[model samples]
Target: MPLTARNPNESENEQDASQSGDEKPVLIEIDHVAIAVNDLGEAIDSYRESFGAVVDHREVVDSDGVEEALLKVAESYVQLMAPTRDDSPVAKYLAKKGEGLHHIGYRVADCDEALERLKSLGHKVIDEHPRPGSRGTTVAFVHPKAIHGTLIELVQE
Candidate 1:
């Protein structure tokens, strides 16, 4: 039997039937999972020992007040973030919330376009404009206040 509609209550025709062709995923894959930690080295070492993942990239982004280590996982990465200075937001986050996942990043085709689309849908954004982020990518943060407490980062590589 073909995939036919069984229940009349299930509006099959109302679904997006036009989207049958293989549409590539808008967000290719998770760019990274950023974990804010007080000690970057320790965090990296711990992850290395536990998961056997090695750091592929490391950089100190003074603009963001963070030193990060990227651990490659297939197409994605694990970004271990630590404060470079006391005034950094990551520092403040670590001081207040201890150590854990800080934000989730969604890879977008264009940061500005994604942000604009989000704003059109009534979502509050933090970065009104795209800003230079770590790893040479343009990024923006979406305010957690509107998204049920999950801080969202939009990245364009």
Candidate 2:
């Protein structure tokens, strides 16, 4: 049975029918799960010992003041992130929240569209526009307060 995807911005027949219930997932896939830690090396070592996961990509996103190690797990990644500077957001997050799961990256077909959808639904957005993310993906962040205290990243892979 096909379920109607009602969009107030569109006409009744124009409403998208792509999503017809739980039969189809709204997001493409789980892009990565980011964990903010005090020490990237220590976290990487711990994952290596416990799960034998190895770093597939390592990048220091100077713009975000974070050094990240991407450990591949199937099609997704376990992103181990550490702060590079005192004023970095990650540093602030760690200071306030301590080392733990930061934000979840959910793969999307179109980041701009996803962002618009969230905004249309009256959700608070951290990034108003899609920006460059690690690994050449375009991304936007949906504010945690809007998503029940879970930071959501819309990733266009």
Q: Which candidate is the best by TM-score?
A: 2
For candidate 1, lDDT tens digit of each residue in 26-60? Answer: 56568889999989999999999999999999999
lDDT, residue 147, candidate 1: 81
lDDT of 2 by residue, 36-126 (tens): 9999999999999999999999999998999999999999999999999999999999999999999999998899998998898888999
**lDDT for model 2:** 0.90
**True lDDT of residue 143, candidate 2:** 98
lDDT value for model 1:
0.86
Question: Local distance difference test, per candidate?
Answer: 0.86, 0.90
- Window of ten residues with lowest summed lDDT in model 2: 14-23
Clash totals for all candidate models: 0, 0
